[model samples]
Every structure is written in C-alpha cells, then in structure tokens.
Target chain A: MEMSAHNCRLVFVVLAVSGCAPPDSTSEEQLRPVVPGGFDSVPVPVHNPLTRNKVLLGQQLFFDPILSLDSTVSCATCHRPDAFFADGKAVSRGVGGRPGTRNTPSLLNIAYHQLFFWDGGSITLEHQVFGPLQNPAEMALDLASVLQRLESIPTYREAFEELFDEAPSLRGLTQALGAYQRTLLSGGARYDRYKAGDQTALSPAETRGYKLFKGKAGCLHCHHGFLLTSLRFENNGIAISKEDSGRARVTGLKEDYGKFKVPSLRNVAQTAPYMHNGGMATLSEVIDHYDQGGREVRGKSPLIQPLGLKEEEQADLEAFLHALTDTTVLAGIEGP
Target chain B: MNYRNNIFIAVNLMVLFLVGCDAATSDTGSTTLTLNLNAQVNGKPLSTDPGTTFDVNGTLISFESVRMYISEITLINSNGDPVSILGDGLTVPAKNEDDEDISHTVQDHIVLVKQDAGIDSYDLGTWPAGKYEKIHFKIGIAGTNNRIDPSQVPAGHPLAKQTDYNNHWNWNAGYLYLRIDGKVDTDGDAVPDDEWAVHLGTERFLRQVMVTHDLILEADQPGILDLSIDYGEFLRNVDLSDPDQRICHTMNNLPVANAVANQISSAFSISTDRKRTGGSTSADG
Candidate 1:
C-alpha cells in the first residue's frame, strides 16, 4: 500500500505508541536512546519491531561477507562504521572491483529517513536491502540464493530459529538488518550538546558559523531539523546533462531532472567525499560549491543562491560542519 | 497461546487473506490497458543534444528538458460508456485559494516523459473486454488535483512532494501542468542565445485531449494503441522570437499556457496500423 508522508508518519506514531508488538517474555521493552533536542521520535514500522536478539543477528549479518555471492564483499565493505557508515570514495566499489554511479550514503540516523537511496526509489529500509544485494556490482546475490546460503549455515539457521522462532526467511533477514540499522543513530555531536542547553559545547567560531548557516547561507531551508535534512530531493545543480535523471528517474517528472535527496549533516566530517556523486572530496569544497549557488542547470532549487561568504566565514562554516561529528555512535560498532 | 505463537498465527492469517484477494482479482480475467507515450521533434525522435537545434517557424531552438503531467484518463467504450482510469486512491490536500481534496487512484493515471528516458509506457490497469472508441485524458492535472499542496500528499502519490512530481510550484501551490525548458537561437549561429522556459499550470491551464479511435479488446487477449506527441507541433504557433513570449514561469502568463495547451489537445492520434488484440494503448501526448 502506498502511504502519504503524513499518513506514513501517523502509521509510525501509531505503531510506536501501541508498542509495535504485544508484550511477551522475550519481547522486552527496548527503550529508545535519548536523542538530541529538536529530534523527532524515531519512527518504527509495525512488522519489524526492535529486539536485542534481532539487532545482534543483524549486526553479524551486516559484517559477514557470506551474504555476498563471492564471500568477499559485505555491507561493511562500503558502509564501514569507522568512516561514519560511508566509504571514503567518490563512488562505492563493489564485487569484482566494479564501481557504482552514486556514492554510498551514510547510514547514520537512516531509520528517520522517509525515503531510501539518493533517487528515493525504495520506500522502506527493508525494501532497500534487496537493491544492493541483488545488484551485480554490489553483493551480486539474488534473494533466493542469499536465503538458501544463509539457511545452509548452521550458525545462522540456529540464530534465526532462536530469535524469530522460524527458519531463515527473506523477511526475517531484511527485518533484522533494518532493525540493526535503526540503532545506528547519532546524537552525541557537539552541535547536539549545544542544542541541548550547553552553551560552551561549541567554540565561538563554530557558533558564528552556525548563525551564517542558518542566516546568510540559508541552508536551514532544506537542511533543518535535528537530523539536518528535510529528506526531500532537490536539483542542487549537479548534473549538466540528462544522463542521470536523479529523482526524476523514480518519479518520471521532468522538473526532477538532476535532483537528489538532501543528505543529513550528522557526522558530516567523516563521510567524504560528499554529494550524491561524491564529486566534492572535502567539506570545504562542498561549502564553496554551495556558496557559488550550484551550477547553471535547469530545475536548480531556487533556495540555492550565491552567499559570497568571505574566506574567514568559509572557514567558520567548515568548523561548524566539523562540530557535527558524533564519535559515540562509532563506539558501539567497535567490538561487533 | 504465547505471544510469539499468537503473532505468528496473525501473520499467517494476514498472508492467507492477501493471497485470497489476489486469487479473486486474477480470476476475473480483466484485460490490462497499457498506455505507450513517445516524444518526437518534427518527424524524428526527440534528442537531448543541446547543440541539435530544430527549426520551429523562423527561429532555431534546443530543448534541455521537456516534461509534463498527464492525468484523469477516460476510455469511451463502443457503447459510449466512459471508463475512468483511476490512479491509487490517495487524497492530497488542496493548496490553492479554494481548498479541496485531490484524489488519486492506483490505476496509473499520472506519467512523466523525459527525452533521455526513451519511450514511456504505463499499465493503466484491467478493464472489461470490449471495444473502445475514444480515449480522453487531461494534459495537466485536473483543477481538484492541481491545487493541492504537494507536500501534504502521501509519499506514494505522484505529487506528494515537490521533488516527487517535479511539476509543482511551491510558491504558487499548484502543479506545473507542462514544463518545457530550453534555449532559442535568434542569430542562426547554432548556439542558443536566450533561455526559453514555458511553465503551464494553475486552474485555468488544465486541458483535456480526446482522440477518436477504434480500440478493440478481446477476452484473454490485450489491445494495443500507439500514440505520439510531436514537439514541433507543440511549438508551431508559439512565437519564440518575441522576448515577451520567450519565458514564462508562472500562472500569471495564461496566454502562453493556453497556446501550448491547445497544441497538446491536438497532438494525439490513434495509430490504426499498431492496433492489436491486446489491452494496451501506445500513444504519445
């Protein structure tokens, strides 16, 4: 069933309030970790409720190369937790050294995303898993083959039975991965601390840069909220031709040509190179590109305008972006 | 029963119910109607090369983008019974002066056409096996659906977000019924000198095109209808040489929009040779 943004949000709230699942001995109340101020409640789907066993299983699956057809590449190969869930490459390299067209987006705080992928093709995290796993350049494994491979493994079969009380299935696999990804949240950034009533959390330069970002730069229009992105697609004037239709490919709309989703600013320092295509290698370059008000392309968002920021102002803005990195989210992935 | 067991039973029941619904729908033997859309400049397929300028009237022009919204499709049977090709039933809150509910059904009513994406086809959904005479559809969204704040619509709806439809003008709170962005070369130098953007939307810009044809559908067999939209015809009357007519990005310019809408209304034709015993229509608009 297709859901509107409002209705989708309502569904999340309703499911969350109703506890997603009935109370049981194994279904312990998993309290959501405290988020930064201004962050909305973490939206959870009804079918995939969070549980300790499922999360652990998912983390293992995410790091295990066995999901790949050749057993050489894994989800972690591109989305390493150390690199803020984004591979430090212009575009992601998959199995057999094949390169993808778009960059691997940071998975931090992805549970709050209304849409998946830069193109917004997949509507749910569970649905998004099949795209990479089956893509020839990525894991290069079909769903049936992947499931059969997992079922063949004694450890995975035993774990699936223990957690879901069933044999390994496609639904359980995707759900577990989705649940673990939801826990990859970021809220311990200095910016988050500053927002939570700690005045000294940000340096004076960083604070000044925040003011410019909200005021002169007008980045707040699209990159507002606690997660820092409105999660809507926009033509930031990246493409010069019709080669990559971006969000237009998904919606089949002409006005969406060269448009891509506005990514979150959390842990912005670590996830580089930036942009959908990873054209900009540094945050300073990204800021410069935005300052010039994007390229001269059709369907460019009207909100993007030349800021004409001074050299010092540019450095200050870069400093503010650096302050958004949250190392605590990375700490959880160290052992597992 | 234990909570896990109860949950498992509920899931099994839901799956069973869904399977039953699918079986029932497939048992009806409903014929599928596919709408095929193709774009052409003059007699040739539309090209994306900015350097490939076409002679429209006395001026040379190149299109950077040609996109529009097509909705509210209705097929008139031989008996004159009008069948509305409904899209998914998702209500969008109106964003115009008069607030209204803009409804969409899950029957593939809205489509976006791009030159680079090649030919586009939409599965309009199943219909009773019969012969259709006339195909009616709007060039832009109808007034009811045109005025809604796109952001308020469900994410699944075509016009849910400005980015989703790419046809909406947030400032106007209305859909851009048609958008053709390109450049016009007045000096005949093969290089575009001035930008030409025609954005048509608002309540007044909505238009419907009716093509008279013999569309036949047989039981267990589908019908095919081929349609084409000629860009040359779309710009035939619009004077690109005149600066006043060169650029229009808002509803305030109704004359330009009306001219394009009139051209769109007449751009559709039923390819009699392409007709077959299938439930699909191949047409360009």
Candidate 2:
C-alpha cells in the first residue's frame, strides 16, 4: 500500500499529462485552478499527500488560537486571508504583543515556493510550521505544548485520528496545516487570462508595464517564470543591520550576507509594505528602489543598476503588478 | 516384534532432536540491554542540579544542561565482525495515507542523552545474547537521517519537533551532536559569573568512539554497558575566562568547534564497575 517517491512522482506526471486533476487534491472537488499559462504543477512532498479531510482539519487549525501559548494568536493572525494571506504591516505582532523582526509574507501560492521564511531557513512547509509556533516573537508555544493543547480538543483529536490515523501529533498537525496552505492557490488573474489567449484581459497601460517588466525594467532577472520568482536568494541591497545579516544568519557564509529570498510578485498590490523588513511602504516605493539600483550594501547583487525609468514607465509597471492580483483565490475558504 | 521395536526407537530419537533445537534457540535469543551514561568531573560524579558546582582549574563551574545525540551504534564480536544493535526499524508515516504499515528505515536508531531531562539511560533494543568485544558509536547523526524533515517524525522521537529540548538547527543544518552549557567563575568569587556554551554539530564534526571492554549479554538477563563521561576532560584546554573563546555554536568559529569535537572521543571511557547501572557509588551529583 505504501508508495515510493519515484512512483508518486510518476503518478503526478501522468496526472499532469492527462486532463484529470492530481490525486493529492486538497478538496473533494478537484483544485481545477486556472493557473497562468505554462505554470508548472504544484510540487507536493511525496511523504505528506494532500487529502480533503486533512486539508479541512488543517484549515480549521490554521484559524484556531489554541496553538498559541496564551490561546490568542493563530497562524491567521499574521497571515490574514483578506490581505492575500499577509498582514498589511511592516512587522507582525505575535502573542503577548511581541513584535516580529521581519515582515509577514503572503501564503498565497506558497506551494510553488521551494523555501520558506525570509532567510529561507526551512526547505519544506511542514518544517516551516514549527518556526512561528516556537519563535518567542511569534505564536510562542513549544511543539510539546501545542500538541498537548490539540490533544485536549475532542474535535481535533477525532479529526487527526481520521486523517492521519494517529493521536494529535507533530506530523498530523504540520501535515494538515501544510495541506490547507497548499490549497490557497492564486493564478486566475488577468495576467494569466491574457496569457491564455484572452485579448481583453489587460488595459493598454498594464500591457505596456508587462513589456517593461521583461524588457527595460529587467524585473525578470530574479522574478522570472510564471510564479514571478526565481525562488533563489539575492542580496537586493536593502540596508543591512548588525542584528539581521539576512541569509548569512542561516548559511554561515560571508558572501551570503544581506541575501534573502526573492518573493513572488503575485498579489503584490494587496500585500503592501514590501521587502524583508517591510521598509518600502507602497508599490511605487518598491519600483523606485529598484530603479535607483537598490541600496549600496555589502554583497549586493551585481545585476542591479540604475534604470533611468521615466515617470510613466514606473506607473505602468505598478499597473501590471495590479493585474497579477486574483481576488477569487479565497472564494471557497471561509474567513477567520 | 523386532520391526515394532526399531520404529519406536526412531520416533524417540526424533523427539530428542526437536528438544535440543528448542534449547539452542532459547540460548541464542535476543535480550534488551540498558546503557547508562554517568557524567563525572575529575573522577567525581557530576549532577545537573543548579546548586552543584565543581572546581575546574581553580575556578568553580556549574553545568546548566548537557544533551547529545548518539547514533550508528554497533557491537564488535571477538571475530572482528560488527553487529548492528539498533536497526529494528523506526515507525514513520507512509507516503500514502492508505498504506497499511508505517514502518520504514529512515535511519539508524539514535538516542538522546540528557541528564537534566532524566534521560541518562537508553534501552538498547534486543541483541543476540553473546559477548561483544567493543562498543562502537558515533557522537552525532549522519547523512539523510540528520536532514530528515523534523515535522514528519513521530512525537517523542529524538529528532521530532516535539522533543523536550531544542537540539536542531535550521532545516538544512540538522541536529547538534553535543550541547553543553555552563557558567564559570572568572574572578574566583565562586559565584560563576561567566556563561559558556559549547555546541558541536554538522556531519564534519561527527566523531566515532570505540571502547574496548568485555560486554556480556545473557539470555533473559539484560546486560548493562555503563559509561563514564568526564566533564573535566571535555572542557580541557578551552578557555572559560575570555567571553569570545567560551562559546562555540559549531558554525561561526571553526577552531573552537574543532577543539571541542576533538576532545569528545577522549572524554568517554567504559566503566568496569556498573556504578550508575547498579546504584550510586561515587558522589550522586
């Protein structure tokens, strides 16, 4: 009954080749996401496959504050669905009103991401779930305490047993949360529609901005592909502080200082306060930072150089970023 | 009458042969053994209590916590052949939910040794009852096991997220081999003013230790392999006065980490007498 990773990958490919949805669909109703044309299939870990019951349980746990030490803040406290799963703040507030160090990132289309966190500390979503749960600045509860809290809830105990065939455990809790987050896919934007042969999907200014994003603006250097990110670490010349060395904190390499994950531009219009520290207040500020060839910092990427972009070009680029937003991504999932 | 007598003799011989086979099976059966790790400082028993302080190089130092991961354990027989001791199979979740069994060989069974957490002893799985010439074990986890997803492991597992203490680095870096935190008195006030933390990790720092001893395991009589870890030897040549040299997180400073890693193999010695296995013989601290 157990499937090997090779066989699971083979099944994923076969499902993709055929017109049918993948077997690891989070909903009983096939995901049937209208992804951007040429968007690759979502990469699911072979160990934790998505299921309807598991996703439902994960979704319920995601909003439940019981995971926190004080039972006040949940994963949804910082990752709000209305703000494209990212709280519209420079830094998120956690349990006991402790201030988070970095900006809260959007979980929308997180399935396509290869790494998690601003520093890319965790490779898998399952492992990433523990970072916030244990960080004193975040939900602020140890894994032992979180498991014990879940064990007390009858509905949680029964749901975990039904889905994972075990008591409330680290594997079940993380896998369920990961499955639910994977279901928050967003690809039915006007940009995707236009790419899918819809002529009236974009306005003239937005279409011009799209051209600049690939051409003069040179945004595609790091933010390439349908996911709008290379999913690699780069030191985009944000002013570095002694406290936060960015990727170097995890990698322990001098060359990796100030480097952080290049975030996806999907739903950029909704999730304001850009950059790892949320230094930029608006999309205009973000474009200006890029046009000015980023900040002068140690280990800054060599690709960044002054663009000398006209006033109207920046506006057009912002319009194109707006077109990438898909309001219907949160249609089925209820509010927290 | 002569044919009936011969047939009865043959049937009696068959019964005797079956009884002999059962006797041999019972003698060679596996018995679960226990491994007791006793911490000592300068030939004296060491305790994890906050009030317990030891005189080290004319300075008083007290250990706050001592934890480590021991893996790849094996027993060498008299013939020089190695027998794996902890490979019964770890239970992990299957790739598919419909899978009947959860058993998988993710890695060699590893044990966490933490005196403060009251986990100084480990129940080594059943091994063939016999004499083992030497006990071989690695100080840290290795390969895929070190980098296994933390969330996927079962609760209460050494590498699981729900472990009692945090021994893990970020996802890619893996678990620490050994973590020893303590405070030392630099000014000789005996108040232990300075804090010191020595953490060694990564595959590069994995050190294999072998103790040559006559470890006997008897059928139905579980054997105990008692070991004494000298805290004095572990902190030898490490300067506790300088704040810079006092700490090693295993990555930032290579020299400090290297010094700590090199001393680990020498810090451990097999106790001839089962001092901790039987009862407290030395100071119970």
Candidate 3:
C-alpha cells in the first residue's frame, strides 16, 4: 500500500488507542526495546516524521541516478550495502567521470551521527542529505533542480502521495533517507555478542585482536562508543598540506586544521582505503600510519602517539576489527 | 477509509473535543503597521543600476545569486526589557526573479512583489493585546534564521516569486550584510576588483535583525510609538572615512560589519525620528 494511506491507517489505529492508552503501559516487555537497547523509539525529527512509504521511496531514490546533474550517479553509487554501506572505490567519482577529492566514508550507524561529512559541517541527517546534491563537483545539481526532477517522476509522485499528500520535496527526500539510515544499524557483531555474554563466539585470533584494540594498540580512546567511534573531529593526519583544512575551513579555527569526523567503526572491515582523503589503501597501512604518530603533522592530535606493536598485535587488531562485521545484516540489504 | 488507517480522523476528533471543551478567547486591540525598508546608501534613499550594479554596490560587487531565511523579532520597552514576536519569518531575495525592481521601473521586476515585507507587528502573543508605549526594532536578521528545514523555507511563498539574473547572490546571502567593495591601495590605486565579500549568517543568522526599542501607544496618548533606524548614524559609526575601515572599499573589510554588528546589536535606543527620541540626543543622555 502507499505510505500516506498506510500512515493514515496507523494514525487512525494509534489515535483510537491513544485515547484509551495502551493495554499496559508499564509492562516490562513494553519498556524493553524492540531492537535491544537500540532505537530511541521517538525516531528522527518530529517535523520529518518517519513512515514506511517515504522510507521505501527514499531507498528507490538512493539507488536512482536521476538525482544527479547527469543521470550517472545516485547516493547508492557510493554507499552500496554489500560493501558495508561504502563503495570500495579509493575515492568516489561523481558525474562526467570526475573523481572526488575525499574518500567515500561508510554509512553504518550513520543515523546516530550528530554531524555529517569529514569536518562535521552538515548538522542534521535531513540537512546533510543534500550535501552531495549541491556540490558542484558531486551530483552538480542545485537543490531546485533536484526538487523539480523529483516532482516530475511518476513513481516519485506516487511515493509522495503514499508518504505525504504534498508532492516531492527536499524534506521528504531527507527524511526518507534518514529513516532508512536509522535502520542501517549494526548491534549483533561478534564483539557485541561477546559483550552481551556469548563468550564462545570469537576464535583465538579474534580474541587477541579484541585485547589489542582496547589496550596496547590505543584504538579505543577515539573509537569508543558502543558503535565504536568517539564521533569527534581529529586531524587523523592524512592531510599532506594545509590547503584542505577540513574542520578548520568550516569553523575558521586554526587548531582544527585537517580534522575530520571520527567515523563509526561498526563495519570497518568492509570500508577499506580509509581516512578523509583516502590516502592509505589498506587497514594494515592505517595501523602503521597511526603507529608513526600520525605522520608528525603540526596540528596532529597528541593522542595519536606511536604504538610499537609486533606484527602479531597488528594482525590481531585487524582480525578484531573484522570480527565487528555482521555478515547477516551485510548480505540482507542491497543499498541504503 | 479503513478505520485502522485513519490517524488524521482521530487527531481531528481530539482537536474537536478540545474546542468543545472550551471556546478559547483573547482580547488585544490590534493595529497593523507596514514597514518600508528603503535600502539606502550614504544617507540617501536607494536607486538601482540597470542590471549592472544595485542600490549601494554595483557589479563592482553584487550578490548575483542567493537563498536565506530570517526571523525572531523583539521590541524594547521604555525602560530596558524586550518583548518578542515569533515566526515573523521568511526567505528573502526569492529564488527566481524577472530581472527588475518593481519600485523603480514601470516595466516591473516582478521580484519586487517577493520583497521581504517585514513582520505584521499586530499578531497575537506579540505585544500585550492592548495599546503600547512605542515600537522599536533592529534591521539585520535574527541568529536562529536558517535552522529551518529546507522544505519549510516556503518554496511557493509569495516572497519566493520572481525571476532573477543568473546567480545573483543578492537575494540569498542577505542584505549586503557587509557591502565592503570599492578599491584598495594594497599595491597602489583603488581597484574595485580588489574587494572581498563577507556574507555572514550560517543558516542561523536570521535574515531579519533583532529590534528592541520602546513603542509609544496608550489608550490615552499618541497613535503609536514607531522607532526609526537612522542609516546615516549606522554608516557614520563604521569607518567608511578611513581606507581600512571602508566596508565598500575594494579590499572589502568585514571587520567593519562585525564592528557595526557589535555596536547597534543590543545598544539600540528608541527614536522619535532621526532628529529626536524620548528626550535626548544630548551626548550624555
């Protein structure tokens, strides 16, 4: 069924029940989360209400290249589901075959992000949806064109009717994408299961990697949340020159030079060719880069101290990061 | 419709129930005030250049294209407190324009209809539902302007109507927030191209400025207390005289905007006109 009809139906059901209250508000099961401790049931922005139809529409939009200036790219062109919501490309290329300057970061657990982009300039998921669309070198279409294009599609118009009676718009696009993004979560990794008391899940190499990840390797200080990222800006030291001052460009602060968002590492094993500018081509190289005290840059974060690890520790950390991948979720979804 | 799928019906029912519970009432004698923001330059009312330059700064520097929102208004009382007017919000210099300012030309810049017609100060919850002392306001924009979701920015709003010249930052970036573009002696002579544009407002600086000045209205007194902004005083306060302080100079000094922003921000006082206020233009008063 179309989304608006579905929502109208759900709204009717909820409203009828809303007046009488639920069967049992204080039930232990009611208090328990539907998806474990995940899902802040309130969900996305209230203004951008989440609905199934819009989310489905957004999924179609994410895969549809009609959003680009030329019909060559869509959001999924970079955020493919099989590759942990990241394209395997060293640096994502946009229309007219132009290569982007920075690497396409992974989208796992992206819904929880407070800011988008390497520097965290885009503040909300809804607002961030248009970043690539407006970029001159990216999708290359201004928002007006994007809106006008969406409004022209019959499928999009039908989707809009199902999702909202009002036709296609940036808000619908953003909210749809955001709702789908919120669903792209990873809470059942081997480590997560291990932490949840199923210790029998990891092999010896994976176990060793878990220890190194927390201890001598010094990886957890920044990559610390349950999602495995402190989610702050740091000059991860990939920037060779001051010309592309990542976070500093947005904030104009001298200290924030080259600092990019510390992306969540939920599906780290699948998102290769890391860092903001995609300078390193492998995870082994990323560990080595960090081991060298982040290439000795002047604005480098002091926390990136050298970790003189033996080969076994590096391998263990890699195995541990790989342990974070939940192949079940990875294989089920096609694209965000 | 399936009874299970109709959320709007239930919500409508609740709204109806609430209205039935009580017929809400409010009493505030209202007065509508129209504001004509004559974009001026050097203490004179503004005039346009034929698509080359605008009122103050011409092609020497023009916001060829733009989109932005402004909101959050405040009115200062006779003493020193502020009353707020919410949602007097809008996105200015609308997206499309037919290449003309309606006021100056008989041919019509249809975009003129899209001009930011300011706030309707007579709305409820603004001033008490009665006569006031005086009305005072600022001319810039509020800080919380651009926080609006792009969808909420009113694409079809009357303000969004008009055909504009290609990429004219004029409407989107906000009222020449800092029009520093004239000439620089960086090497020697005053070269107009040597200008830098400092268009502030991070989707947060509301296109509209905060205003706090006393309004003079009473059941017993005058018609209304309307405070006037002296553009002359604003320009004089900035170092337009010094080569370095000139915001309109080729080098484009933005510190002047920051400085001017700092000066008139919270320090605005009510005025009867350019020549008078409550009692004093006296240096001490």
Candidate 4:
C-alpha cells in the first residue's frame, strides 16, 4: 500500500515520539516494527526484543563516560546525535585524542544493516559494540573493567538489577546499546515523500536530478534500493595511495586490497565529509571527483569513468541529494 | 446456506477462474527481440587499431578505444503505440570476451553496450509475436537508473566487475555515456600531435534515436533488428580542428559533448540489405 508523503512523515514522527517513552510491561507493542516507505520489516533478533527499559538503559550507558578507560569519553563523543550519529571529522578521535584510520559512519538506520564498519568486519550490531569499547584509540576499556565500574555505581547497579534481575553483564550491556541504536531511524526525507507519490515534493531541478541519478548519472548502480546502499565492498579508487588496505586488512587478499563496504546514503547531508577516508569536504567535490572519473589506480572498479556533467546539472544533483535530509531525524531527541 | 445455493456459487467461481486463465493465456505467446550493434567509418568497419586513420575535416585520427551505453528501448506497434521492452527494468550488457552473457538487472529500464565488443546483440525480453516497425531507444542510460552504484549490481555483471569496459565514474556518480579516445594530427603532419579523448556523460548528454525498420517476430523465434553507427557521420557535424571541441575528458566541456551527441543521433540507423536508412533525432543539448 502507498502512503502520502505528509502521512508518512506524520507516522514516523508519532513512532519516534512513542518509541522514546520509558519501557514498561505494556510497552511490548512498541517493539513491533515501524518500518517506513521502501523498507521491509526491521529484523529483530528473537533473543533481544526491543523494550523501553533496555533502550533507556542503553541510552544512559551511551552518554555515560564510564565505558571508557579514563572515564572521559562516551559513545556520544564519536557518534553524536546532533551530527546524525557521526562525528563531523575525517576520522573520528577516540579517548586521549587518538585518531582512527577510517571515518566514523553514521548510525542512522544502522539497525537495517547486516554488517558494520567500512571493512564490514563486524557481523552483527551486538558484535560491533565491542570494537569501540575495546579499541585502543576508542574507549580502551575491557568488558570486565567496564562491568566493575558500572557495578560500583549505586544508580547503575540498581538499574541493572531492576532491568536484568542481575548485576551488569557484558551481554546485557551490548544488547541494551544495540536496542537503543535500533530505534535510531532516519525517515521522512523529501525523497521519501517523492517516493510516496507526491509529485510536488521535489523541485523541478531535483526531479531532473532524480532522473539523472537513475539514468545518465548511474548512482543507482550501487546505491540503489530503499536504504540507498548495496552494503557491499568495492574499490572506487579512493585507496589509490595504498595508505590503507581497507577490507584487505581483514581478509588479507590481494584482490580485496582497496575494497571497502558501500555506505548507506540516509542522512548523508548531515553526515560529512564523505567517503571512507572522509577526504571530500563537500558534495560538489565528491561530484567533481566522479565527473573526472576516479583517480587512475590499480584495482579501481571498471565502473569509474568520467561523467562530463554540466555546472547546472551538478547543482541540480546536489540539490536532489540535499532533499534527502530528514530534519526530524536531526532534532536529537533524547528519551526521559 | 442451502446446498443448492452453495452448488450454484461453486459453479460460478469455477467459470470465473476458467475465464481468468483464458485471458492470461491469450497474452502468454512471447518472442525475443534481438538488437544488433555495428560500427562503420567511411563505409568500412570501424577498427580499434591505432594504424587505421580516418580523415575528419582534414584531420587524420585513429581511435584507440570506443564505447557507449544504450538504453530505454521501445518498439512501436503497428498502431503507433510504444511498447516498452524492458521488463523488470533489467539491463543486459554487451557480450564479453569469454562469450559470457553478463546482464545487470537493476530497478531501472536500460542496457549497457560496449562498442569494442564484437557484434553484440541484446535479447530483450519476450513480446507478443507480431510485426513491429520503428524501434526507439536512447543512446545513453537515463532516469534514476543513472546513479546506481555498480558494486550493488551482481558480482559477475559487467558493470560490477573491476574492468574499464564498464565505463562508470564512481566518484562522479555517473556513467561515461560515450568514450572515444584517439590520436589526432591537427597540423596535417605525418606524426600525431596530441591524444584526443572525447568522453561525454552527465544527464545532458543523453540522446534518443529512433529507427524505422520492419521487425517480424514468430512464436518462439527471435527477430533480428540490426543498427549501424557510422563513426564518420558521428563526427560529421563536429569541427575537430577547434581546440574547444578537440579534447573533452571532463564534464566542463559541454559544447563538445553537445556537438558529438547531436552527430551520434544522426549517425545511427537501420541497416537493411547492406543499405542504410537515415534515421536521426534532434538534440536538445
């Protein structure tokens, strides 16, 4: 069934507000999938159904700096909600100002993804929680230490006991964090409206840009479908310098050297700079790079060719991309 | 309900189901339409060899590579109704060297064809077996299909593979609609002065070409529709001597792309009995 753009936006706003309430026995109905247009039912692991209490506890832990070794940085430090759950930096800085190799991908609609990170090393959202918590450049705290710290806090201890009927455990912590992230959905963009059969949702330039995007521009070859990402790895010539091995670092295959996981374009306007390295500063720069074709490098995907877009056409394409922004998702609403 | 009423309802339902089946079967007969692509320069088959030079407005040029994408195929029925042949919006790429038929099926209605590939034919899906005249197709990919990421295409699809034939610019998020790289001697000297690369793309570069031809399709039999693109005619309108149109490797050079795209629309036509029909479309560029 099709939904009007306005109705879709209203539905998402209601879902977002209602999902933010504290968990209770009657909150079980809230856990039902609230998928928007062009999306299927959100895959929820049976072992960990979304609950208000779990999401609230996870939200608290995410903002709390106690997860770090020095207790000075929180998950919010890198995945800032205001920044669309991505720190506005080329590469995110971890605890003690240590830098990472790749850019911090936005967490908007991350629950819909089957893999995580630019390399896609993490298989599940629960598994991904350990990477930042234990990475030397990130939280730099072991699970045992994190649990001990949480157990020492009277409030955290009571909360954990009340929620899990036990003390803070590694499983509970990751599940709670994953639960909160699963609720971080980005929908109601103008693009969504346009897809909902609202012809006037986009300007003429954006409409032309959308046509170009599907036609001559060829962005849909990879970034297609509802989430706007294939979620696969490819070498788009961004690794020409060989400074980073990308996915090869994990797989150790020569052919996989420059390949990196394709990222979703949801909330892309808010999450920048773009690319795995965050090299391109603006959408124009990114468009220019593709217009000139990518850097001629070994293992560059054959798809990289010069686009020859006119200045006005480039502007139109940029405007179309801007229309993808969902202001509702950018509000940074925190639950009580 | 009474048994008599229930029996009567059952008979009506069976009759309605039979009629629905008959309606579906009437449109079930299908035939494939094969589109053949060939190139020529001054009545000779266009060669990729650097030694083969063709004079264009007093300039000697030899093409090192030539490639393009064709999409939005439509067959005009006898009644003049345009029948879209793209089912499920999938694209069938040109035949590769391994004789592998690589087709990338996306959510868009178009197809990719490489010029260097040997006599490639795209077997568009089955249609109602009949006679069709006037085939219409665009010279490049168009619409939302243009911005798809090649990586998302199936791994073995030509566009998804890591090769130059795909001719996609990932950074620019577009496809190279047409790429003609060659060496040109502008000074009328024996040796080539500079390398000329005419790479055209972007939404503005999209050109639509319609060719009038007689295509007869029989049940389960493939119908052949041959199209010839004259490389010489493709450069007929463009002044190669002009520096502004001499080399275009980026989107900044729209004038050159416009000139070439205009020529391309006029250059393509249906080849019948070794003779060609002049079929062209006006370029909006």
Worst 10 residues of 2 chain B by lDDT: B276-285
DockQ of 2: 0.28
Once fitted onto the true fold, the runs of candidate 2 whose alpha carbons sit more than 4 angstroms away are A1-38, A330-336, B1-31, B57-59, B91-104, B128-131, B170-172, B182-196, B216-221, B245-248, B252-255, B275-285
DockQ, candidate 3, comes to 0.08
* Chain B TM-score (each prediction, in order): 0.77, 0.80, 0.42, 0.76
Give all candidates' CA lDDT scores: 0.70, 0.76, 0.52, 0.69
Best by TM-score: 2
Quote the lDDT for B167 in model 3. Answer: 15
Q: Mind giving the per-residue lDDT tens digits that candidate 1 earns over A1-336?
A: 111112211111111223344333345454353434577767655456677667667777888777788888889788876677788999888889888888899988898985678887655676567668877778887656787889999989998777666777665687789877886767788998899889999999999999998998888999988889988889887754445678776555679778888999988888889898889999999999999998888999998889999999999999999899886665544332
Candidate 1: C-alpha RMSD after superposition: 15.5
Q: Residue by residue across B1-285, what tens digits does model 3's lDDT show?
A: 687669878999999777644212113233333232333334343323312323232212222222222223344444344445443444321111222111110111111111222321222222433323333333333222222233333344322312231111211222322222332223332333344232333222223334433234332222333333333333345433344654431113346555544433332333334422243321111
Tens digits of per-residue lDDT, candidate 3, A85-186, equal 678877887888788877898876676776678877655565567668766567877767777888898888877656655677655677677755665556
Tell me the DockQ of each model, to 2 decimals.
0.03, 0.28, 0.08, 0.01
- Over 4 Å off in model 3, which ranges? A1-43, A193-200, A238-240, A250-255, A333-336, B1-28, B43-50, B54-59, B63-72, B76-83, B88-196, B202-285
Q: State the weakest 10-residue window (summed lDDT) of model 2 chain A.
A: A7-16
Which structure is stronger by lDDT: 1 or 4?
A: 1
**Predictions: Cα RMSD each:** 15.5, 8.1, 13.6, 21.0
| Local accuracy of candidate 4 as per-residue lDDT tens digits, A1-336 | 111112222123223333443343333444554777778766665445677667777778878888899887788788877677798999888889999877899887888876567876554565567678877888888766887898999977887777666677655676788877787777779999999999999999999988878877777878888889887788887744456767665444678778888888777777889899889899888888877888887778787788889999899888888888888774535422
Native contacts present in each candidate (fraction):
0.00, 0.52, 0.09, 0.00
Q: In what order do the candidates fall by DockQ, top score first?
A: 2, 3, 1, 4
Query: Against the correct fold, how does model 1 do in TM-score?
Result: 0.54
